[model samples]
Structures are given as C-alpha cells and as structure tokens.
Target: MRVAVLGGGLQGCCVALALAERGIDAAIFDRNDQLLSRAAVANEGKIHLGYMYANDVSYSTARMMMQGALAFAPFFARHLGSSQDSLSISRPAAYVVHRDSQRSPGQVSQYLKTVHGLIREASGRRGDAYFGRDLTTAPRMWSEAEREAEFDPQIALAAFDTAEVAIDPAALAGAVRSRIEADPRIDVRLQHQVTSVDDADGFDVVLQARCGILRERFDHVVNALWDGRFAINETRGLRPDRPWLHRLKYGVSFRLPRGTSLPPSATFVSGPFGEVVSYADGLTYLTWYPVCLQGISTDVTPPEWPTYPAEPLRSDLLQGTLKAMAQFVPCLRGLDPGGLEEVTVKGGVIVAWGETDIYDPRSELHRRFEIGVTSRGRFHSVDPGKLTMAPYFAEVCAGRILQDIVR
Candidate 1:
C-alpha cells in the first residue's frame, strides 16, 4: 500500500527512507523548495552521549540514551560520504560544564564517575576508565582557544571525554536525499505542503500549493511536521492540546578572527549554555548548548510565560546571544571583538511544553522526543527526533504502524 509522509526534515527523511526500504510506496511532501530547511539546517549537530543529562537524570535513562547515541556513527557511515570530503565525528568529545548552582563538587565528582563508568561498560568489558581535562592547553593551544573560541577555566567542574560526536547537517541531508531518490518506487514532491488530513476508509489528505489546493487519499498518513502538530490534529476533528506549545530558541553562527588558530574541533561548556564547535570545513564557529534554559523557570508557562518570541535576528535576540556567549567564553568580550566575526542567527522551534505551564528540563517530558496518535490511532504526529536518535526512532515508529497492517 502507499503512504504519505508529511514534512521533509531529518525525521521525515528517515521515515520515508524506512518505508521505501520496506517495499512500501512512500512519498514526501514538503513546503520548502529544498530539503532540511527550518530546524534541521539550524541544528548545531551535537550527537549526545548522555553526558549532558547525567546529573539531571536516572542512571537507567542515561545509559539507554548513551547506547542510542552510538547508533549515529553507523547510520552516517552508510549514508554520508566519499574519501575526499566526509562527515567525520567531532573531536575532543565534550565538556560537561558546572556552575555555581546547588550541585557541590562531591556531587559533581560522583556524576562524572557515573558517566565514565557507562563509557567503559559500552566498550564491552569491565575495566578502568578516565576523562580528559585542563581548560587551558599549552601555550600554543591555549593562546589559540583564547583567541579563537574562548574556554573559561572556572566554568567547568569536571571534564570528561565520552563517545559522543557531531556531524554536518548539510552532508546528512545530502546522503538521505541520495538514498531516497535512488529508490525508483519513491516519489518526492518539493514545494508541496500537506495542509490537513481526515478519516474516510483510510484518510483523505489535503495539499496547499502555489498552483492551488490539491487532495488525495492514502491508507496511512504520518505527520512528521515538527511544528505543525497542533493544526494537524484539528484536521482529524480533534481538539488541539493547549498544553502542547512551541518553545522558541535560536542557533547563533559566527566566525573567529583571521590569522588565528583554533584549539580543537568541538567544545561543549556546561556552566552556561555554551558550545564552540569547529565545523567539518574546520574554520567556522557556532555557540552550542544554548544557555537560555535557565532563564525559563520550572513553573512558568504561557499566559504567564517569559519566553522569547519566534523571531530571528531581532535586536533582543542578538544581544541576548552575545551576552550569553561571552559569559562562558570570556575571550569573546569586546566592544568590537576583532576575534569574532560574521555573527548570524536562525530561529528554532522546540515542539514541547512545560507541563501545566511549568517547564522542568529534568522531567522525562523534556528529555525524550514525542510520538503521538489520534484517539482512534488512525493519524500520528511525531516530535523532532534529534539526528542522533532519528534512525532508531524511525524504525520504532514505522514498525508500530505497519506491523499491525501487515498482519
């Protein structure tokens, strides 16, 4: 049978590829003329290894996520590149930063031990393990990191090197596109947006385009539109969940000064939302780990919310990013920091909510990607399954939906 997959971001691409592999007819309908626009392109490309969540989550949850992260490298290898240019993993793994919060040094030490233990366990034998440290490298590397991407010594409580990585979003989109297009059975419609869906024998789908409205019927419709969840549910005559609101964020891209040398490939600072990643091209810089998470309290949600609007490059956002970045990377301080250049910003959407209007990062609610179904199970909408977790998530989603139908 044929199925229509809505949206063409990473999760959508993964789902479509999975369906085509299953010998089922799958078509991708996307609004943008190109693939992986919106949040996909803006993704700072961190393939988490559970280090970021060790202090905030249970050992079991962290362990599961770590194993899940390992899937990304194999997946990328199958789809990513040639010898000349490739999507290799990030260097220097990551740094779990600490702040002047309630968590003490003793507590921080225990958490690092736990994270390192998991890394050793994943290696297949019980053995001793260690982590990398030193915020300041040598006179050379330290000078470079300071001049290029600043790393503050005090912000880090403990530093650990785990089996995590980062990949180029552009390369990823290309690989998926190549694989999907190679399948003669699949049809990919560009500039076509799935407007809505309804129930008949299966489901009637509506499409909106510059050419006008078009409609079709499909046995199953997978709503992989990241931010379109609320509207799609209404298509099935369901009341929208007021609690499911989109939280806005941003990805700031910038460059370091010329005649400068960078210390490492990627560095994730823990204290404040800070990250400095050297892209595959090996020269550009991006602030990872948006420090804005703390501004959002546990109890604040809409109607009484203090969240940023869904706007990009606004004065407030630009200033906010600059201020946040400087906090963890002091080298970035200057009226006209000649060291940093070409600052650009992109808007991002987090398809999540603070339960009852209270946002808690530690809660399972914000930790995992969301997959939901209509009351009758005829229609489904997926949250943004991060790049690292997309492959596994796609398999689970596809198997659950198609397994019953095949039987």
Candidate 2:
C-alpha cells in the first residue's frame, strides 16, 4: 500500500523510514524547502543524559524519553554509518549548581535523591530495554571553595556527576535523513508545498507552490507541524483545542572564540534567572532566558530586562549568566571577551498545553495515526531534540499503521 506522510520534519521522515522498513511504500511531503532546518540550526547538539527533566513528574514524558534515547542509539549508529566513538555521544558528568544562600544544600540533596530514585524506579520497570542502565546517578555536593578551585572562582556549592549526553543536533538529523534517503523504497521530495488534504473519491493531498498545484493520492496521511498548528486547522477545517500553543521561551547561541576552554560537561545553573548553559565547538550557549515580567509573560524578556540588544553581549542577561558561571567556575571570568565571536538571538513561544503540559500526547497520537492511515504521505515538524526521539516515534507509528491496515 502507498502512504503519504505530511511534513518533512524529523517526525515525518522518521515515520516514513519506519514504514519503508516494513516493506511499505511511503512518500514524504513538505511545504518548506528547509524542513527541520530552523530547529536543526538552533540545536546545541546535546544527546541529553535524561536529566533535563529529572524534576518532572510526568510519567509518560519521562518514559518516552528514556525509551527514545535507547532507540535513538542504534538508529543513529546505523543511519550515520558511524561508530559510537565518532558520534560524540559524550556521556559527561552533569551538575546542578546553585547558590548556598538561595537554597539549602539539604533541599538540593533531597531533590537529587528524589529524581534519582524516580529514574531508577522507572528504569527498573522498563528493564534493560530502555535507558535503565544509562541513567546517571544523583549529584554529590562540593564545598564552595572546592567548587571554586575546580570550576571557576565564583562557584559556591556544586552538585556534580549526573548522567547526560551531548551531540550535534544538525549533524544527527542530517545523518538520519541521508541514511533514509539511501533506501529506494522512500522518496523525499524537497521544495514541495502541501497546501491541503481532502477525502474525495480517495485521499487527495494537494500541493501549492510557486510552480503550480500538484496532487497526490495516499491511503494514509500524518500531520506533524511543530509550531504551525494553524496550517493543519486551515487544511482540515477543524479546530482542535490546543491549550499549549506558545508558552515556552528559548535562547540563542553565541559562538565563542576558536580556542575557549569549556567545561567538560553540561551545567544547569540556578540563580535569579535560572539558565541551562553549555559550551561546545567553541560556542557558549545559553537558553531559557525568561521573557516574563511580574510573573506574567511580558513584552520584556527578563533577568537581563532592558539592557539587552543595546549592549547585547554585555546585557544584564549575559552578565548574570557570567556571574552564575563564575560562581560555578571562576576561570569563566578570565575568559577573554575576544574569544566571543558571534551571537544569535532565538526566542519563540514554546508549544505547551497551558502552563502544566508541554506536549499534547493525544494530538500527537492522532497525527501519527492520520499519517499511518494515509498512503504515500509525509509529515514534518521542528524539534531540536528530534534526533533523539524520531527513531522510536517512526517505529511506533509504522507498527500502528500496519496494524490498522491489516485489521
């Protein structure tokens, strides 16, 4: 049977690859020439050691992430045609550093213990099939002076040795795409814009572009639009309740000098404006810059507030970040400003379900099934973390599609 996957983003490509692996013919379609390109470009290339959301209680998200990480391993290895050593799957010892006065060391310890226990429990239930073994242990506290000596001079107390992995997000996605395209069963059409979908005599998917209207028929179709839910609503003429549309804030990456000594591991620093900062490929990246003012999403992105752009690099945000960095590692202060090369500002409404849910599981499932049901289809969506999760998503979607068709 022929299947049409909508969107050439990671999700769509993954779903298509899975379908192809099952000996099913699938066609991937996208309206954007730069599918997954935007999200891919903004990536810091971290494989994520599963600690980013250690505090999250969402069992489903946690479970998916764990399973997804493992699934990604083989998929990436095969797709990239590279050994584990070449992939930069750096299993670094992660840390969460906070000021001693801001939060008690005991509270921080408790938090780590709770998260570690949860990870262990979750891994145990999943057996060796998931990331149970790969999960990192909770961090241990370091004295203020010791942290200063080891890191930089500004560090107070350091919680070191948590599990985390890092990678080049763009390279990873490109590798996956390259591998999938090698298979003749899959056809990736670039510069094709899918404007609408209709169930006429058969499933008709329409494409509108500068060229003209192109049409294709498919037995199944999937919709995976990153932040572009409006396209789906316009195409299907259906308005599904999406509470978590744009509630997330992100940061841009600034390329540091060619020869800057970065920390060996990724660090999560909490201060007046907590941020996730990491240095890779001579670029120091900072994200989660708050745009909220007075506890509300304000016009001004905060912690650094008004001083941004005018002084960009010297802005309050970067200064606070630098201060936090110094607290964790004193050497950061001495790092030459000449080493700072370029800065890219990236802030967007992170998709979420109200303030509580970050992802819509139900909508995701529906979109997957829609693609599976379509013949000769493709789908796309922007996900900086797409490389780590798309493989499993593809496998699951393919299995579901086959099941639906056979039954």
Candidate 3:
C-alpha cells in the first residue's frame, strides 16, 4: 500500500517508520529540505509525564500523558534501532513551583502525587518500561533548606524531584534520520510543500515544489505538518470543531562554562514560567515562557518566521531567557554574559486548543487531552498534542490505516 505522510517532524517520521516496519511503502512530504528540521529539532525535547498540567484538575491530561510517556522510549527505540539505555537522557527534573504560579505549591503537590499514582497504576507489570527505569517510586519534594540552597528563596516556593527527563532532540533526530535513510520502504520528499489533499478514490496530494506543481495519488494520507497541519486539514474539509491556537516559542541552548557546576534539569510549573534542561551531552537548554514565547495566531496556520531569528532579536531572547531563568535558579546568572559557549536561539510553532494564555486558570491550554488522530476513511489528521505523544500516536495512526485496508 502507498501512504503519504505530511510534515517530516517527529510525528511524521514516526508514522513513516511504523508503516515501513509493516512492509508498507510511504513517502514523507515536508517543506524543509531535511527531516525533523522544524519543531522536532528546535524545542526542548521533554518527555513529559503530566506533571506540568496541574491546572487540569480533572487529571484527564495526566492520564493521557502517562499513557504516551510509557510507550515513548520503547516505541522510539525500536524504530530507531537503538537500545533504550543508550538514549541521551537529561537529568531528573525538579519541578519548582514559582511564587506567582497559577496554582499554589500545596495544590501542585497534591496534583503531582495523584499523577504519580496514576503512572504507577498504569505501569502494572511492565516494570522499567519508561526509558528503562522503574517509575513506581513516588515523587520526592525538597525540604525548605534544600529548595532554598538551589533556588532563590523569594522566587521558588517548593521543588519536587521527579523521574521526568527529556531526550536530546539532536541525538533523536540524527538517529531517526539514519534509520529513515537506511530504510528502502520510506521515501522522503524534502522541499515539497503540500498545498492540499483531495479525497477521491483515495487521496490526491498536490505539492508545490521549487520546480513546479506535482500531484500524486496515495491509498492513505497523513497530515502531520507541525506548522501547517491545520491549514491542510481545513483544505480536506476536516476543520477542528473546537477553538485552537498556534503559538510560537523559542528555546535557547548553550554549552556550560568550563568548571561551571551544572544546575539540575528543572521546570517551573503551574504558570507561564520556564524550564532549564541540562542534557548528558553537555547541551544546556533554557526557555523562559514570558520572554521566549514570541507570538500567537488564531489563524489556521501561524506566520512563518526564520527558524533562527535575526541578530538583535536572537540575542535579546537569549539574554532575556537567561535573566528570567536566573530569577529562580540563581546559578544561571553567571552564564549569561560571556561565560557560555555556542549559544543558539531558535523558535518552533506549537499547535494546541486554547484561546487564552497559560497564566489563566480557566484557559483550555491547561488541558491537552483533546488530541490524536482524527480520520475520515483513509485520510488521517494527527495532533500529537505534545512532543512526548508523537511515537504513541504514530503507532495508533498506522494501526488505523491498516484496518482501513481490511474494510
């Protein structure tokens, strides 16, 4: 069977890999000249376990995230042909509660305990399936003294040690690219911008390439574009019923200064705070929500910006993120001016359902459970929700497409 998978981001790569494993030929169409060049590579690759969604009081977001987190390592490792233990995992993150957080430390703590309970319950007999580590252990909250030592006492109220870690997106992209290049069943059509997908006997995928327009028919089509997935979905008459949002956020990464003691991988939660991830490969990533988030669009597709922003804006984001992060983690103050190396600031588009910013308690962005594959016949549109859910949803999409063949 022939399949066309739009967008060469993590979701599209996973979908193509899954189908190739099943002996199905698939083509990945992406505007970028390389796979995983956009959101897949630009952001902090947090493999979230739902600790960030304390605003979703119903715990539905926690449940959905737990399901995906469990399957992330195994599914990704299998497709990448690598050992789970070999993945370059960041250090265990400390969830620091900001002083001006939307949810109080007590409330966020309760939510963390509840989410951990769900994770333990979900693991069942699949011990150590999550990144090859036991997830049954309860989360540990730091003492007042412990929190005060690492964080500014005025900005950080509490901190909890959780097993949540992020995979290095560069390493992941390289691995996936190697696997895709070696596979004969997957054809990657780079620099091909898919303008639309029309439903006929199957699906006609119209592509606007540098040369000219090209059309191709495929038995199945997967809309997985990180930047323009919604726009393509609308062309296929698969408009999202609920309100949606497309946000642009930036991630700043640099090498830690020589002789600098690395700060713990940390995420400020329950508000519009930020995260600092120090990966094992010596790449430290920082993102301050208030400073690094650039724009928002209610339109079907977000405005296009260069992956690497220009000089002054890029420098501004770097300095601003460092300043904002140092407010909570004081160690970052030293690395801002001239202590760091190879600093880069890049932005990626985040698509989710919400009209309000994250600071609002009533915002729909707090709950991200309303995402996955929505299919009409053989055409599939995927919203992986978060980067953590990509591999899990890819498997689901492949299974659904296979089932369509039987009917």
Candidate 4:
C-alpha cells in the first residue's frame, strides 16, 4: 500500500521507516528546513529507560514508550550503526526533599520499596528484585558541613539511582531516516509541506509549495507532527471540537564552562521557582528546560523567545538559569561569568496536562479521527516521549490502519 507520512521530525521518520519495513511504500514530508537541527545541536541525548512511568500504567502512550525503548535498541544496532557499548545505563537516584519537615527513615524506605516494586513489575520481573540494584537512596537535612561537601549545597535527601539511559535524539532520528531512505520502497521528500489529505477512491495528499500546490495519492496517510496538531488542523479547516491542542513553549539550553562535574552522576534538582535542573557532560552543560504549565498557550517561535543580547550571544533565559544554578552550585558564584555563546533553544507546542495525558488512549482521539475521515489526516499529535517511543506508535498505527482497510 502507498502511504504518506507528514512531518519529517522524529515521529514521521520512524513511522515511514516502520511502514517501509512492512513492505509498504511510504514517503515523508516536513515544512521545517531544520527538522532535527535543534536536537542535534543541543541536547545531551539521553535514551530514557521505560521505568519513569508507574506499573499500573494502562495507557497506549505508556505502552508505546515502553515498547519503543525495547524496539529502538535493536533498530539502532542493526540499522544506525550504533553499538551496545555506546549506550550507558545508570541508575541515578531522584529525591524530593521537603523544605521544612523531615521524612522518617521508614518513609524513605517505603517510598523506595514502592518505586522498586513498580520498576520490577514494569520490567516484567518477578519477586522483590530491584530493577537497578545499583540504585540506592538516603535522606537527611543538610548540615553546614554537608552543604559545603558537594557541588550543590541545596541537595537534601538525595534520591539516588533511578534507571536513566542517555542517547543523542538527533543522531537517533538521523539514523532512522538514513535507514528508511536506503529502502527502495521509501521516498523521503524533505522541505515538502503537506497541506491537506482527502479520500476520494483512496487518499489524496496535497502539498503547498513555492511553485504551486502539489498533490499525491496514497492508500493511507499518517500525521506525525510533534506538538503541531492544532496548527495543521487549523490550516486545513479541520480543527477538533475538543480543546486537545496544547500550548507551545520553549526549552532553553546553554553550554556551561568546559569542565564542571556534579557528584553522584546526573541529578534532577528541584528549585524554589518550581523548575527542574539536570547536569550532564561532566557538568559542563546545564539545561533549564522549562516544563510548560498546563493550559498555557503561546505562538512565539524559539528564535523569537526572550534573548540576552541584540546579536548572537546568550539568551536572557540562560542567564536566569545560571542564576538559579548558583543557588545550588555555590562555586558558580566565583566563576568568570562569560557571555552566552551558542545558545540553542527549541520552541514547539507541548501538551502541558498532568501525568494522565501521557498514557490516555483518548489522547489519540484527534489522530484516529483525522486519519480515516478528514483530508487533514496527515499529521500526528504525540506526547513527550515521541522520539523514544516512535517505533511502537508506528506499529500500533499501522496495525489500526490495516485493520480499517481490511474491514
């Protein structure tokens, strides 16, 4: 069957690749010239272990993520020329220390036990075995001596050793794209923006180009726009009735001085401002990636977000991030404050709802409805783990499409 997958971003690439693997002819389209550019330039590129979600997770989103992590490993090894050695699995403990009160030792143990149980069950293991034996935890109010002991003075009740895997998102996307392009059945059209999709005996995919409007007929179409669902629908006059579209926000990342290290590997530091911080690459790079609050909306592009200098310097947001870093890493206060060099920010719309959004099948409402009925079926709305979970999603979507065709 001929298929058209819109958006050359990570999701679209994966979907196209998966279809090609099934011996189905497929093509990919994207409007962005720099589809994987931002992720390639910035991000420490950590491949996440599926343990982030709880054991009782029943949502399609969660299943896709879990299955994707497992699927991506072999796909990367076989197609992308990635080796198992390139991957580093670490159990970095995460902690949530209260400001005023102390959690009892029993409470800490119980918490860890619950977490361990969840991880074990999710990983399909029996008994009380912890998923990451190296993972451990400790809780204590920081003494002044303790404050001076580590790089981050504010750390309390260190939650140590949670399952985390880091990989380059850009490299992963490029690898998948390369593999798909190698297949004779797959045709990748870069810089081609699909404008509409119509089902007339079959599916008619329309594209808007500088010269004129272009159209291609396919047996099926899949929309894989990462956070661009609303924009695409509006463009096609097929906006969903429900308020499913999420607000757009920016993720700001800055390159720290070449050699800084945080003790106990990478940790997510919770700040007073309700922001999360993580250290990577010998602590030389710190990201103040903002988790956009739910229900907030923005039309601002990444390059237009508030910046530091008139020209290419550092972003103002990055400066604010450094200030926050100083609260925990006091040594930062003594370092020579240099101008922000090469600050790359990725601005896109994201679903900012609570944890429930990640695993809900209803969240796929727009995608499912758009595919079969509307000519606007060429886009996909996905959650945060789109890159990590693309393979599973592709399989599921392909299965659904096949079922529909058969029926």
Candidate 5:
C-alpha cells in the first residue's frame, strides 16, 4: 500500500523512511524546493534532556524529552547508516540560571537533579546511550569562583554542567537526504504545498503548485506540516481543542576566526534569555530570545514571515543577539562582529500549546508533554514539538499506522 507523508521536514522524512523500510511506498509533499530545507535545517539542534523546562514542576515534560533523547542516537544511526559518533555533536551545555530568572537557582537545581536521576535510571534499564556518552554521573554545579570566571556575575546566578549536547541539524539533514534519495520506495515531491485532505475511502490530498492544483489518493495520510498543520487538520474536521501559539523565532549562525576560544556551549535558563553554542566544526550559533523572537500567532495558520531577514534588520539581529548573549557569556562581550565569517540569519515557525510566551512562569510553554501522534482512523496528525522529538515520534506514528492496517 502507498502512504502520503505531508511536509518534507525532519518529521515527514523520518516517517517516510520508516514506511519505506516496511515495504510501503510513500510519497513526501513539501512547499520548499528541496527536502529538509525549512525548520529541519534551520535552528540549533538541541537534543534536550528536559533541563530547560524547570518551570514544569510535574516532571512530565522532562521525562518525555529524556525518552526521546535516549532514542535519538540509535534511531538516526540506523536510518542514516552512520555511527552515532560521526554526527556533529556540540560540546556539553552549561545551563546558567539568570539572576532574574522565573525559577530560583535552588528550585532549578532541584528539578535538574530529579531529571538526571530519571535519565540515569531509564538509560540503564534500556542500555540506550545518549550520543554514545556515559551518563552515569550527575550534572555538577559550578562553584562561585568558576561561575564568576565563565559568566558575568551580574547576570548569571548559578551554572551547572550536564551531559546534554546538541547535534548540528544541517549536517544531520544531509545524511537523512542521502538515505531518502537512496531508498526506492520513498518519493520526494518538492514545491508541492498540501492545501487540504479529504476522506474518500482512504484520503484525497489536494496540492497547490506552480503548475496549478493537483490531487492524489493514498491508502493513508500523515499531516506533518509544521507551518500549516492546523489548517490541514481542520479540513478533516480535526480542529484544535486547546489554546496554542505559533511563534516565529530566529537564530544566527556564523563562523569564528581560527584559534578563537569560547566558553562551553551554554543556555540561560528558566526565562526568555538566550543561548550561545560554539560547535567543534568552527560554526557558532547564538540566539537571544528577546531580540530574535519575531512574531506570534494564535490562529490555525500563522502569518507569513521572511525566513531570512534582509538589510540592516539582519545586521541588527546579529549584533543584538551577540550583545545579549554576552550578558551571560562574558567572553563575547567585546568581540568585533566584523571578524565573524559567513554570518547568516534564519528562523522557522515553532508550533506549541501555549497562550503566553516563555516569560511567564505559569506559561504552558514551560511544558511540552502535550505533543506526539494523534490519529482519527486512517488519518494521522503528528506534532513533534521539538527537533529532539522528531525521530522518536515518527517511529510511533509509523507503528500506529501499520497496526491499523493489520486490524
């Protein structure tokens, strides 16, 4: 049987690959000219272990993230046909708690310890390694002297070094694309925007392309579009039942000059601060929430925004991101922006279940346990909330769809 995987981002590609492996012919539809060119390639690829969601006191978000993080290495290694060590893994992150963060240092520290304990237990039980690293030890908090030396004391209240690391999504996307191209059962349909889906024994997927509208029938359909997922789901009478937000967040990527030194890739915690990641491959990524965040929409479909900012606006974002990041990573304070090589600014739409932003201590953004595969008979809608959840949730979506066929 043939399957239709809507949207060729990471989630769609993963689902397509999984189905192809099962001897099912699958077609992937995307608006971009190429696969994995949108949100899948943009943004910092943080394989979160739930340390950032300190405000979610229930620990559910952290637990869900840990499960996905554990499965990330093996899942991609199997699909990409490469060893986990070959992936571009960033340096372990030092989570710094800001002086005015929504959660206190003590509260954040307690939450991290609890999450780490769960991670260790789950890893041991399944014998699943996180990026091939040994996570037997707990995260270590920095001393006052160490914290002062690594970060500006005025902004940073405390720091902890965890085994959490980020994979370069750009590199990972290339590997995934190669695998998809080599697979015979998976078809890649570029520049095809899925306008809607209708029930017709199976499903009829309507598409909008330059040539005009087109339609195709499939035994099953998966709604995996991040940009217009809600709109397509609504066409199938599956409107959202809860409050949500589609936030457009930006990230800056630049290459550092030779022999440039930087602190460990760090993330400021429990609020709308920012993060600075210096990858081993000489590429540095910076994102300051207050400046890089562009727009937010509560509608089923978010308003269109340029993925790449032009002119002085782009320069403003780069300068502002670095300046804001330096508030915590003191080493970047006086670095000349001109010295940075190949600087580029790009962002993607982030769909989450929240009415407010992360600034609020009580915002639903603090937790992300509400996402995954949701199905209504033969049609499925997936919301892989973060990049970390894409592979794991894709497996779930594929398995559930296969089970439906058996019955």
Candidate 6:
C-alpha cells in the first residue's frame, strides 16, 4: 500500500523517510521549489531541550523536551547518512536572563533549580546533556551581584548559561532532503501544491504541480502542513470539534555592531518579554515573540497562511526587534536594526493542540515539536513545537501510521 505525505517541510520529509525505512512506499508533495525555505529552514537554529520549556510545567513531561533532544542526534546522524561522531554543532551556551521587575536573585536561583531538574531529566549522572559532556556544556549562573553591574542597572536581575546547541537549519534540512531523496521508495515531489484531499477508497488528493494538476489515491494521508493543515483538512469536511490550532509568530534576525563583546559561551538572552538567540549560520541575533511588541498580529486567532512579501521585514518589525534586544543586552544598544543583509527575518506560525493553560511562555500559544494522528485514524498531522524535536515526532507518528497500514 502507498502512503501520501503532505507538505515537504521538516515533518513531511521526516515522515516520508520513516515510512520508507519501514519499507513502506511513500510520496512527499510540496509547493516550494526550495522545499526547506519556509519555517523549517528559517528559524532560530537551536537544539532545544528543556531550557526553552522550563516555564511550561503544565504537561506531564514539562522538561521532557530533553527526551526529544536526546533522540535527535542519532536520528540526525542517520538522516545525513553521516558516520561522524557528531553533527554540525555550535555551542553558544544558552542564557535565561530575568528582569528586575519580575525576578529576584532568589527567584533566579529557583529558576536554575528547575533547569537542573531538566538536566537530570535529560541525563542521569552525566556531565553533559545532548552531545556527551557537550550537551550540558556546564550550565552556569552569573549571580544577581554579577548582573547588576553589566546590565542596565534596573532591568537585569540574574543570568545563566543553559547548555544548548545551535545546528545549521539549511544544512540540517539539506542533509535530510538529500538523504531522503536518494531513497527509491520515497517519491519526492517538489513544487507541487496539495490543492485538496477527499474521501475515495482511502483518500484522493489533488495536486497543482508545475506541469499541471495531478490526482492520486493512497491508503493513508499524512498532513504535516504547518499553519495550513487545518484549512486543508477543513476543505475535506474534517473539522476540529477538538482541533489543534495554529498562529503566526514573527521573528527578526539581525547582526550586532562589530566588536560587541559578549560572553564566550552565552547565547539567546531570555527574559519575560525579551529573547535574543544567536543563530549558527551568520551568527545573527534573532529576537521575537513575547519580546518583540509587534511579532504577533493584532488578531490572528486563526492565522492565515503568511503571505509575506518577497522581502518583507517591515520597518515596524525591525524597530520593535531592536527595542526588545536592548531590553536584554545592554551592549546591543544603538545598533541600527536596519540595513538587513541577505536572510534576516525568519519564522512563521507555530502550532499548538489540545488545551494550553499558561500565559505567555507557557501559554496556549507556546511552541511544541510533537506529532499527532487525527481522530479519523488514517491521517496524521505533524503538529510540532520545536525544530530540534521534529524528527522524534516523525519517528513516533510514522510507527503509528505503519502499524495501521500493515494491519
């Protein structure tokens, strides 16, 4: 039996690869000529564990993100068909900075305790977390006393190294795409948009390819179409009574002034409404979400598929991003957010399913990288939260799909 995988993003590519690994014939359909150009490629190049999810304790495995982080290394090695001891790793130790208004030294210490729990969750009696002693690159803290002098006197409370790595997105996607494309069982269809899917024997999907429209039937259909998945399903009369939702979150990646001295290891300054992630490629500083005042739209309850212009990091967006950056990094003050060179703005809608209860960081809109099968049982949606964990989600979701097909 053949399976049709929709959307050629990270999830779609991974699902196809996983299915092929089990010897199940699969096809991937996507509209982007450069399949990894969208949200999958354009993102803060983080290999996140629980540092990002420390605030999100509502879930059983609030710090369980380390579970996914652990799985990625081997899976990524296999995806690249590489035998190297490690993949492309940029360890710019992560930081979770706090503002004086919201956090105190005691609170910062408590926060570090939570991170320690995450490390324990990630590795048992191990020095490191993700890459040997490398993953847990020794989480360190600059006490409240240390922070007071370096930061804007009033705003800075405390800061710490979160032991996170940054992987090159384009490289990761290219590796996965190249490796998966070489497999004969996995048919890779680029520049092909899945226009619609309907009930036939299993599912009949219409595609608008570069040449013309094409239709195919499959035993099962998997939708890894990020923000657009819901709309595509809605067209098929598959509405969500209990549905997973998607929203657009924008990010602005910019370069700091030359000779700006920063911590040798510290990266991604994090506070309540301020975040700055230094990416692997270009070493560009990306700020967004709760930090940037205008990252989320006024009302994108159910965000539309982002119709971003060919080159659009609107002036207002850039302005807001710089403001957020200064809130965290005092050194970034007065750096012009303009004069963007090459790729600058990166990000799109992140998905959330089920009931999200927290506000802001742990809020309903928080990002997750997990997979799901629809109630219909035949279709699986790649509802992801983070870039680092997409492969793990695909592995689990692929197993579920294969089990059904073989039975």
Q: What TM-score, computed on C-alpha atoms, does each candidate reach?
A: 0.75, 0.71, 0.97, 0.69, 0.97, 0.81
Which has the greatest lDDT? 3
Q: Write the per-residue lDDT of candidate 4 for residues 1-407, one digit (tens) a residue.
A: 67877777666666666666666777777765644542222344444343332222332333434445555565545445544334433324343332321333345445445644444445564221222232233223334565455445344444334444555443455555556667797787766766666656666777886667887887777777655544555554655554443433343444455654443323342221222334454323344434322134433121222211233324444555566555655655544445444455444434333223322423332121122212324333433344555555666666656666567
- Candidate 6 residue-wise lDDT, 1-407, digit = tens: 88898988887888888888888899888887866667787665676666554444443333546666776776766656553243456645545555422334455456556766656755775444366545434456776666654555455455676666767675677777767767899998888888888888988889988789888999888888876677788767766665454545565655444565542233333333545555444455455545332333222134444433234445556667767657656665656666545435555665666354224344444434334445466866666567666777888878887788668
Q: Roughly what TM-score does model 2 have, to 2 decimal places? A: 0.71
Clashes of each: 2, 45, 0, 20, 0, 7
lDDT for each candidate structure: 0.56, 0.52, 0.88, 0.47, 0.87, 0.63
* Over 4 Å off, model 3: 83-86
Model 3 lDDT, residue 360, Cα: 84
- List where candidate 1 sits over 4 angstroms from the true fold: 60-64, 80-85, 116-150, 237-242, 255-259, 263-272, 288-323, 330-344, 356-366, 369-378
lDDT for each residue of candidate 1 in 217-313, tens digit (9 for 90 to 100): 8877878777665567666766544445455555555555654454344344323354655544443444534433322322112222222234433
**RMSD over all Cα atoms, model 2:** 7.0
Report the poorest 10 consecutive residues by lDDT, candidate 2. 365-374
Instruction: Please rank every candidate by lDDT, starting with the best.
Output: 3, 5, 6, 1, 2, 4
Model 5 per-residue lDDT tens digits across residues 1-407:
77999999999998998887677789999998889987888778999988889998999999899888988887888877654456788888998899889989899899889999989887886654687787877888999999999888878888999988898888888888888988999999999989999878788999999999998999899989987799999998888788999898899988877776765688898889888777877788889999999899998889877778887878899998888777668777767887789887988899999889998889999889999999888788999999898888888988987887788
Give per-residue CA lDDT, model 2, range 1-407, as digits (tens): 77777667666777777788788888877655654554443444454434444333343444445456667666655455553335444335446554532334465466556656666665564543332245544566656555655564334455556665656454555666666668798887777776777875556878776778888887666655444534553566554354333333434446555555665444553333333445456555554333321122312121222212344434444455555555555446665433455765433333333333222223331111111122233322223233456677677768877876688
* Model 2 lDDT, residue 191, Cα: 71
**Distance from true location, Cα of 20 in model 3, Å:** 0.9
Distance (Å) between predicted and true CA of 277, model 4? 8.0
